[model samples]
Target: MKRTVLPFVLLLAAACGPRYGMRVPDKLVEKLPYESRIELLESENDLALAIDTVDEASNEVLRARDAIRRAKARESAAEEEENRAADTASREVAKLAIEEARARVTYLRAKQRLNVGLRDVEQLALRCAFARYELARLQSTRKAKVEGSEKLDVKKYEGQVSQCEAKVKEERAELAEDSAQEKTAREAWEVKKAALAKKTFDARASPYVENL
Candidate 1:
Protein backbone atom coordinates (compact mmCIF):
# COMPACT_ATOMS: atom_id res chain seq x y z
CA MET A 1 0.00 0.00 0.00
CA LYS A 2 2.78 2.44 0.89
CA ARG A 3 4.68 1.78 -2.33
CA THR A 4 1.53 2.27 -4.46
CA VAL A 5 0.66 5.54 -2.70
CA LEU A 6 4.20 6.92 -3.18
CA PRO A 7 4.17 6.26 -6.95
CA PHE A 8 0.73 7.86 -7.31
CA VAL A 9 1.95 11.01 -5.46
CA LEU A 10 5.08 11.17 -7.64
CA LEU A 11 3.00 10.88 -10.80
CA LEU A 12 0.75 13.73 -9.72
CA ALA A 13 3.75 15.89 -8.87
CA ALA A 14 5.28 15.32 -12.30
CA ALA A 15 1.99 16.16 -13.99
CA CYS A 16 1.70 19.54 -12.21
CA GLY A 17 5.38 20.55 -12.15
CA PRO A 18 5.78 21.85 -15.73
CA ARG A 19 2.62 23.96 -15.63
CA TYR A 20 3.70 25.58 -12.32
CA GLY A 21 7.10 26.39 -13.74
CA MET A 22 5.49 28.05 -16.79
CA ARG A 23 2.98 30.07 -14.77
CA VAL A 24 5.59 31.83 -12.62
CA PRO A 25 7.33 33.72 -15.45
CA ASP A 26 4.02 34.37 -17.17
CA LYS A 27 2.68 36.02 -14.04
CA LEU A 28 5.89 38.04 -13.61
CA VAL A 29 5.70 39.34 -17.19
CA GLU A 30 2.05 40.26 -16.77
CA LYS A 31 3.08 42.74 -14.06
CA LEU A 32 5.19 44.75 -16.54
CA PRO A 33 4.27 47.03 -19.50
CA TYR A 34 6.38 44.92 -21.85
CA GLU A 35 3.46 42.68 -22.79
CA SER A 36 1.44 45.56 -24.22
CA ARG A 37 4.53 46.87 -25.99
CA ILE A 38 5.08 43.48 -27.60
CA GLU A 39 1.44 43.33 -28.72
CA LEU A 40 1.67 46.76 -30.38
CA LEU A 41 4.91 45.79 -32.13
CA GLU A 42 3.44 42.55 -33.42
CA SER A 43 0.35 44.37 -34.72
CA GLU A 44 2.56 46.80 -36.62
CA ASN A 45 4.53 43.91 -38.09
CA ASP A 46 1.33 42.19 -39.24
CA LEU A 47 0.03 45.38 -40.89
CA ALA A 48 3.32 45.84 -42.76
CA LEU A 49 3.26 42.24 -43.99
CA ALA A 50 -0.36 42.59 -45.11
CA ILE A 51 0.51 45.72 -47.12
CA ASP A 52 3.23 43.78 -48.98
CA THR A 53 0.82 40.94 -49.71
CA VAL A 54 -1.75 43.42 -51.12
CA ASP A 55 0.91 44.79 -53.45
CA GLU A 56 1.67 41.28 -54.67
CA ALA A 57 -2.01 40.61 -55.22
CA SER A 58 -2.22 43.79 -57.29
CA ASN A 59 0.63 42.49 -59.50
CA GLU A 60 -1.16 39.16 -59.88
CA VAL A 61 -4.29 41.01 -61.06
CA LEU A 62 -2.22 42.67 -63.81
CA ARG A 63 -0.75 39.32 -64.87
CA ALA A 64 -4.19 37.78 -64.91
CA ARG A 65 -5.47 40.61 -67.11
CA ASP A 66 -2.68 39.86 -69.63
CA ALA A 67 -3.56 36.14 -69.60
CA ILE A 68 -7.21 37.05 -70.13
CA ARG A 69 -6.33 39.05 -73.26
CA ARG A 70 -4.32 36.15 -74.66
CA ALA A 71 -7.14 33.71 -73.89
CA LYS A 72 -9.67 35.93 -75.70
CA ALA A 73 -7.42 35.96 -78.76
CA ARG A 74 -7.19 32.18 -78.64
CA GLU A 75 -10.97 31.91 -78.36
CA SER A 76 -11.50 34.14 -81.41
CA ALA A 77 -8.95 32.11 -83.36
CA ALA A 78 -10.70 28.87 -82.39
CA GLU A 79 -14.01 30.30 -83.62
CA GLU A 80 -12.47 31.02 -87.00
CA GLU A 81 -10.95 27.54 -87.11
CA GLU A 82 -14.35 26.00 -86.40
CA ASN A 83 -15.82 27.96 -89.33
CA ARG A 84 -13.11 26.62 -91.71
CA ALA A 85 -13.43 22.93 -90.69
CA ALA A 86 -14.94 20.88 -93.56
CA ASP A 87 -16.06 17.76 -91.61
CA THR A 88 -18.41 17.29 -88.66
CA ALA A 89 -15.70 15.68 -86.40
CA SER A 90 -13.19 18.46 -87.20
CA ARG A 91 -15.79 21.14 -86.44
CA GLU A 92 -16.69 19.46 -83.15
CA VAL A 93 -13.01 19.43 -82.13
CA ALA A 94 -12.61 23.12 -82.96
CA LYS A 95 -15.79 23.93 -81.07
CA LEU A 96 -14.43 22.14 -77.99
CA ALA A 97 -11.17 24.12 -78.35
CA ILE A 98 -13.16 27.34 -78.43
CA GLU A 99 -15.03 26.31 -75.31
CA GLU A 100 -11.73 25.58 -73.51
CA ALA A 101 -10.25 28.97 -74.43
CA ARG A 102 -13.44 30.74 -73.42
CA ALA A 103 -13.36 28.90 -70.08
CA ARG A 104 -9.79 30.09 -69.47
CA VAL A 105 -10.73 33.70 -70.17
CA THR A 106 -13.73 33.52 -67.84
CA TYR A 107 -11.66 31.96 -65.03
CA LEU A 108 -8.86 34.51 -65.31
CA ARG A 109 -11.19 37.50 -65.33
CA ALA A 110 -13.11 36.33 -62.26
CA LYS A 111 -9.90 35.42 -60.43
CA GLN A 112 -8.44 38.88 -61.09
CA ARG A 113 -11.44 40.60 -59.56
CA LEU A 114 -11.57 38.18 -56.61
CA ASN A 115 -7.91 38.76 -55.80
CA VAL A 116 -8.47 42.51 -55.71
CA GLY A 117 -11.44 42.16 -53.36
CA LEU A 118 -9.63 39.67 -51.10
CA ARG A 119 -6.62 41.95 -50.76
CA ASP A 120 -8.84 44.87 -49.86
CA VAL A 121 -10.54 42.77 -47.18
CA GLU A 122 -7.22 41.49 -45.82
CA GLN A 123 -5.76 44.98 -45.54
CA LEU A 124 -8.85 46.29 -43.80
CA ALA A 125 -8.89 43.34 -41.37
CA LEU A 126 -5.25 43.88 -40.43
CA ARG A 127 -5.86 47.58 -39.98
CA CYS A 128 -8.81 46.85 -37.69
CA ALA A 129 -6.79 44.37 -35.62
CA PHE A 130 -3.87 46.81 -35.36
CA ALA A 131 -6.17 49.53 -34.13
CA ARG A 132 -7.33 47.26 -31.28
CA TYR A 133 -3.73 46.60 -30.21
CA GLU A 134 -2.96 50.28 -30.41
CA LEU A 135 -5.92 51.09 -28.19
CA ALA A 136 -4.90 48.38 -25.72
CA ARG A 137 -1.34 49.74 -25.51
CA LEU A 138 -2.63 53.25 -25.00
CA GLN A 139 -4.94 52.16 -22.18
CA SER A 140 -2.24 50.05 -20.54
CA THR A 141 0.27 52.90 -20.56
CA ARG A 142 -2.33 55.31 -19.14
CA LYS A 143 -3.12 52.83 -16.34
CA ALA A 144 0.56 52.41 -15.54
CA LYS A 145 1.07 56.14 -15.30
CA VAL A 146 -1.92 56.59 -13.02
CA GLU A 147 -0.65 53.85 -10.78
CA GLY A 148 2.95 55.09 -10.60
CA SER A 149 2.29 58.77 -9.85
CA GLU A 150 0.20 60.51 -7.22
CA LYS A 151 -0.01 63.78 -9.18
CA LEU A 152 -0.91 62.36 -12.64
CA ASP A 153 -3.88 64.19 -14.15
CA VAL A 154 -6.29 61.55 -15.48
CA LYS A 155 -8.09 64.10 -17.67
CA LYS A 156 -4.99 64.50 -19.81
CA TYR A 157 -5.33 60.90 -21.08
CA GLU A 158 -9.05 61.03 -21.86
CA GLY A 159 -8.84 62.87 -25.17
CA GLN A 160 -6.19 60.55 -26.58
CA VAL A 161 -8.09 57.47 -25.40
CA SER A 162 -11.33 58.75 -26.91
CA GLN A 163 -9.68 59.30 -30.30
CA CYS A 164 -8.15 55.83 -30.28
CA GLU A 165 -11.48 54.30 -29.35
CA ALA A 166 -13.21 56.12 -32.20
CA LYS A 167 -10.56 54.94 -34.64
CA VAL A 168 -11.04 51.34 -33.51
CA LYS A 169 -14.80 51.55 -33.94
CA GLU A 170 -14.52 53.07 -37.39
CA GLU A 171 -12.06 50.45 -38.60
CA ARG A 172 -14.19 47.66 -37.16
CA ALA A 173 -17.18 48.83 -39.20
CA GLU A 174 -15.12 49.14 -42.36
CA LEU A 175 -13.67 45.66 -41.86
CA ALA A 176 -17.18 44.19 -41.63
CA GLU A 177 -18.27 45.89 -44.85
CA ASP A 178 -15.08 44.87 -46.63
CA SER A 179 -15.50 41.26 -45.55
CA ALA A 180 -19.03 41.22 -46.94
CA GLN A 181 -17.79 42.62 -50.24
CA GLU A 182 -15.13 39.93 -50.42
CA LYS A 183 -17.67 37.23 -49.74
CA THR A 184 -19.94 38.51 -52.52
CA ALA A 185 -17.00 38.68 -54.93
CA ARG A 186 -15.95 35.10 -54.07
CA GLU A 187 -19.47 33.78 -54.54
CA ALA A 188 -19.77 35.53 -57.90
CA TRP A 189 -16.48 34.04 -59.05
CA GLU A 190 -17.57 30.57 -57.96
CA VAL A 191 -20.82 30.89 -59.90
CA LYS A 192 -18.96 31.93 -63.04
CA LYS A 193 -16.47 29.05 -62.66
CA ALA A 194 -19.20 26.47 -62.13
CA ALA A 195 -21.16 27.63 -65.18
CA LEU A 196 -18.07 27.69 -67.40
CA ALA A 197 -16.92 24.28 -66.18
CA LYS A 198 -20.30 22.74 -67.05
CA LYS A 199 -20.34 24.40 -70.45
CA THR A 200 -16.83 23.19 -71.28
CA PHE A 201 -17.58 19.66 -70.06
CA ASP A 202 -20.72 19.48 -72.22
CA ALA A 203 -18.78 20.66 -75.28
CA ARG A 204 -16.09 18.00 -74.72
CA ALA A 205 -18.65 15.22 -74.23
CA SER A 206 -21.07 16.15 -77.04
CA PRO A 207 -19.23 14.05 -79.63
CA TYR A 208 -19.66 10.86 -77.60
CA VAL A 209 -23.44 11.14 -77.11
CA GLU A 210 -25.89 9.52 -79.58
CA ASN A 211 -29.16 11.21 -80.56
CA LEU A 212 -32.15 9.75 -78.72
Candidate 2:
Protein backbone atom coordinates (compact mmCIF):
# COMPACT_ATOMS: atom_id res chain seq x y z
CA MET A 1 0.00 0.00 0.00
CA LYS A 2 2.83 2.44 0.91
CA ARG A 3 4.67 1.76 -2.38
CA THR A 4 1.50 2.31 -4.42
CA VAL A 5 0.82 5.63 -2.61
CA LEU A 6 4.41 6.77 -3.28
CA PRO A 7 4.01 6.26 -7.08
CA PHE A 8 0.70 8.18 -7.08
CA VAL A 9 2.30 11.12 -5.20
CA LEU A 10 5.23 11.21 -7.70
CA LEU A 11 2.75 11.23 -10.59
CA LEU A 12 0.92 14.19 -9.01
CA ALA A 13 4.20 16.10 -8.59
CA ALA A 14 5.12 15.49 -12.22
CA ALA A 15 1.72 16.71 -13.37
CA CYS A 16 2.10 19.87 -11.28
CA GLY A 17 5.45 20.80 -12.87
CA PRO A 18 5.56 23.97 -14.97
CA ARG A 19 3.84 23.49 -18.31
CA TYR A 20 5.89 25.95 -20.44
CA GLY A 21 9.39 25.27 -19.22
CA MET A 22 11.22 27.43 -16.68
CA ARG A 23 10.09 31.03 -16.27
CA VAL A 24 11.69 33.68 -14.09
CA PRO A 25 9.37 34.77 -11.33
CA ASP A 26 7.82 38.19 -11.93
CA LYS A 27 9.17 39.59 -8.65
CA LEU A 28 12.70 38.69 -9.68
CA VAL A 29 12.33 40.25 -13.16
CA GLU A 30 10.60 43.38 -11.88
CA LYS A 31 13.71 44.75 -10.15
CA LEU A 32 15.91 44.39 -13.25
CA PRO A 33 15.61 48.04 -14.35
CA TYR A 34 18.88 48.80 -12.59
CA GLU A 35 20.63 46.14 -14.60
CA SER A 36 19.25 47.10 -18.06
CA ARG A 37 19.59 50.57 -19.56
CA ILE A 38 19.72 52.25 -22.94
CA GLU A 39 23.17 53.45 -24.02
CA LEU A 40 23.28 56.82 -25.76
CA LEU A 41 24.75 56.68 -29.26
CA GLU A 42 28.27 58.22 -29.24
CA SER A 43 30.07 57.33 -32.46
CA GLU A 44 29.53 59.42 -35.63
CA ASN A 45 28.29 56.33 -37.44
CA ASP A 46 26.00 55.57 -34.56
CA LEU A 47 24.60 59.10 -34.65
CA ALA A 48 23.81 58.81 -38.35
CA LEU A 49 22.23 55.42 -37.73
CA ALA A 50 20.17 56.96 -34.93
CA ILE A 51 18.88 59.65 -37.29
CA ASP A 52 17.91 56.99 -39.84
CA THR A 53 16.21 55.02 -37.12
CA VAL A 54 14.19 58.07 -36.00
CA ASP A 55 13.12 58.74 -39.58
CA GLU A 56 12.03 55.16 -40.02
CA ALA A 57 10.17 55.05 -36.75
CA SER A 58 8.34 58.23 -35.62
CA ASN A 59 8.94 60.38 -38.72
CA GLU A 60 7.86 57.67 -41.13
CA VAL A 61 4.60 57.16 -39.28
CA LEU A 62 3.77 60.83 -39.81
CA ARG A 63 4.92 60.70 -43.44
CA ALA A 64 2.67 57.72 -44.13
CA ARG A 65 -0.26 59.72 -42.77
CA ASP A 66 0.53 62.61 -45.11
CA ALA A 67 0.78 60.16 -48.02
CA ILE A 68 -2.75 58.92 -47.43
CA ARG A 69 -4.12 62.43 -48.03
CA ARG A 70 -2.00 62.72 -51.16
CA ALA A 71 -3.21 59.33 -52.39
CA LYS A 72 -6.84 60.35 -52.02
CA ALA A 73 -6.14 63.61 -53.82
CA ARG A 74 -4.51 61.61 -56.60
CA GLU A 75 -7.58 59.45 -56.99
CA SER A 76 -9.77 62.55 -57.21
CA ALA A 77 -7.48 64.06 -59.83
CA ALA A 78 -7.42 60.85 -61.80
CA GLU A 79 -11.19 60.93 -62.00
CA GLU A 80 -11.12 64.46 -63.41
CA GLU A 81 -8.40 63.48 -65.91
CA GLU A 82 -10.53 60.55 -67.11
CA ASN A 83 -13.55 62.84 -67.43
CA ARG A 84 -11.48 65.34 -69.41
CA ALA A 85 -10.39 62.59 -71.76
CA ALA A 86 -13.96 61.51 -72.19
CA ASP A 87 -15.04 65.08 -72.95
CA THR A 88 -12.44 65.23 -75.73
CA ALA A 89 -13.53 61.90 -77.23
CA SER A 90 -17.21 62.83 -77.47
CA ARG A 91 -19.25 65.71 -76.10
CA GLU A 92 -22.56 63.89 -75.75
CA VAL A 93 -23.48 65.10 -72.23
CA ALA A 94 -21.21 68.18 -72.36
CA LYS A 95 -19.47 66.63 -69.35
CA LEU A 96 -18.47 63.05 -68.74
CA ALA A 97 -19.95 61.94 -65.40
CA ILE A 98 -17.08 61.74 -62.92
CA GLU A 99 -17.25 59.83 -59.62
CA GLU A 100 -16.32 62.86 -57.57
CA ALA A 101 -18.79 61.94 -54.87
CA ARG A 102 -17.28 58.50 -54.47
CA ALA A 103 -13.81 59.96 -54.60
CA ARG A 104 -14.65 62.25 -51.68
CA VAL A 105 -16.05 59.32 -49.75
CA THR A 106 -12.90 57.26 -50.35
CA TYR A 107 -10.77 60.19 -49.28
CA LEU A 108 -12.79 60.48 -46.11
CA ARG A 109 -12.31 56.80 -45.33
CA ALA A 110 -8.57 57.07 -45.82
CA LYS A 111 -8.51 60.04 -43.48
CA GLN A 112 -10.48 58.11 -40.92
CA ARG A 113 -7.94 55.28 -41.04
CA LEU A 114 -5.15 57.77 -40.60
CA ASN A 115 -7.04 59.29 -37.70
CA VAL A 116 -7.09 55.89 -36.01
CA GLY A 117 -3.33 55.63 -36.36
CA LEU A 118 -3.01 59.14 -35.02
CA ARG A 119 -5.09 58.31 -31.99
CA ASP A 120 -2.98 55.25 -31.24
CA VAL A 121 0.16 57.38 -31.17
CA GLU A 122 -1.61 59.99 -29.13
CA GLN A 123 -2.53 57.38 -26.55
CA LEU A 124 1.07 56.22 -26.54
CA ALA A 125 2.12 59.76 -25.73
CA LEU A 126 -0.45 59.83 -22.97
CA ARG A 127 1.04 56.64 -21.53
CA CYS A 128 4.47 58.25 -21.39
CA ALA A 129 2.94 61.31 -19.75
CA PHE A 130 1.39 59.06 -17.12
CA ALA A 131 4.70 57.39 -16.40
CA ARG A 132 6.30 60.77 -15.87
CA TYR A 133 3.40 61.85 -13.69
CA GLU A 134 3.88 58.83 -11.48
CA LEU A 135 7.60 59.50 -11.14
CA ALA A 136 6.95 63.14 -10.31
CA ARG A 137 4.42 62.16 -7.71
CA LEU A 138 6.89 59.81 -6.10
CA GLN A 139 9.58 62.46 -6.18
CA SER A 140 7.39 65.18 -4.72
CA THR A 141 6.41 63.08 -1.73
CA ARG A 142 9.94 62.04 -0.89
CA LYS A 143 10.67 64.77 1.68
CA ALA A 144 7.90 63.59 3.98
CA LYS A 145 8.98 59.97 3.60
CA VAL A 146 12.67 60.63 4.16
CA GLU A 147 12.53 58.69 7.41
CA GLY A 148 10.75 55.80 5.72
CA SER A 149 12.20 52.88 3.82
CA GLU A 150 14.98 53.27 1.22
CA LYS A 151 12.45 52.82 -1.58
CA LEU A 152 10.18 55.58 -0.28
CA ASP A 153 12.91 58.17 0.35
CA VAL A 154 14.03 59.39 -3.07
CA LYS A 155 17.22 60.87 -1.62
CA LYS A 156 18.40 57.43 -0.56
CA TYR A 157 18.72 56.60 -4.24
CA GLU A 158 19.54 60.12 -5.35
CA GLY A 159 21.71 59.18 -8.34
CA GLN A 160 19.30 56.55 -9.56
CA VAL A 161 16.37 58.83 -8.86
CA SER A 162 17.91 61.72 -10.70
CA GLN A 163 18.87 59.52 -13.63
CA CYS A 164 15.40 58.09 -13.78
CA GLU A 165 13.88 61.59 -13.58
CA ALA A 166 16.10 62.69 -16.44
CA LYS A 167 15.00 59.65 -18.37
CA VAL A 168 11.36 60.56 -17.81
CA LYS A 169 12.03 64.14 -18.83
CA GLU A 170 13.65 63.09 -22.09
CA GLU A 171 10.87 60.62 -22.83
CA ARG A 172 8.15 63.15 -22.05
CA ALA A 173 9.75 65.77 -24.25
CA GLU A 174 10.11 63.36 -27.16
CA LEU A 175 6.55 62.11 -26.82
CA ALA A 176 5.19 65.65 -26.60
CA GLU A 177 7.05 66.59 -29.77
CA ASP A 178 5.64 63.53 -31.49
CA SER A 179 2.13 64.38 -30.30
CA ALA A 180 2.49 67.92 -31.60
CA GLN A 181 3.64 66.66 -34.99
CA GLU A 182 0.74 64.22 -35.11
CA LYS A 183 -1.67 67.03 -34.38
CA THR A 184 -0.10 69.16 -37.09
CA ALA A 185 -0.19 66.30 -39.53
CA ARG A 186 -3.88 65.77 -38.82
CA GLU A 187 -4.61 69.48 -39.27
CA ALA A 188 -2.72 69.60 -42.56
CA TRP A 189 -4.49 66.50 -43.81
CA GLU A 190 -7.84 68.05 -42.90
CA VAL A 191 -6.99 71.25 -44.76
CA LYS A 192 -5.88 69.36 -47.87
CA LYS A 193 -8.95 67.15 -47.81
CA ALA A 194 -11.25 70.14 -47.57
CA ALA A 195 -9.51 71.87 -50.47
CA LEU A 196 -9.65 68.68 -52.51
CA ALA A 197 -13.37 68.34 -51.86
CA LYS A 198 -14.05 71.83 -53.12
CA LYS A 199 -11.71 71.51 -56.08
CA THR A 200 -13.15 68.17 -57.13
CA PHE A 201 -16.66 69.51 -56.73
CA ASP A 202 -15.81 72.48 -58.95
CA ALA A 203 -14.17 70.24 -61.55
CA ARG A 204 -17.18 67.92 -61.74
CA ALA A 205 -19.65 70.78 -61.76
CA SER A 206 -17.73 73.00 -64.16
CA PRO A 207 -19.55 71.78 -67.27
CA TYR A 208 -22.90 72.65 -65.71
CA VAL A 209 -21.41 75.91 -64.48
CA GLU A 210 -20.22 76.73 -67.96
CA ASN A 211 -23.66 75.92 -69.41
CA LEU A 212 -25.43 78.17 -66.92
Model 1 gets an lDDT of 0.52
Write one digit per residue (lDDT tens) for candidate 2, span 67-133: 5566556556556666666545333222222333333344444445545554444433333332333
lDDT of 2 at 17: 46
Q: Which candidate's lDDT is highest?
A: 1
The candidate 1 region of ten consecutive residues with least summed lDDT is 19-28
TM-score of each: 0.47, 0.31
Query: For each candidate, what is the lDDT?
Result: 0.52, 0.39
Which ranges of candidate 2 are over 4 A from the true structure?
A: 1-98, 146-149, 152-212
Which residue pairs come into collision in candidate 1? none
Best candidate (score: TM-score): 1
**What does candidate 1 score on TM?**
0.47
Residue 166 of model 2, lDDT score:
63
Worst window of 10 by summed lDDT in candidate 2? 35-44
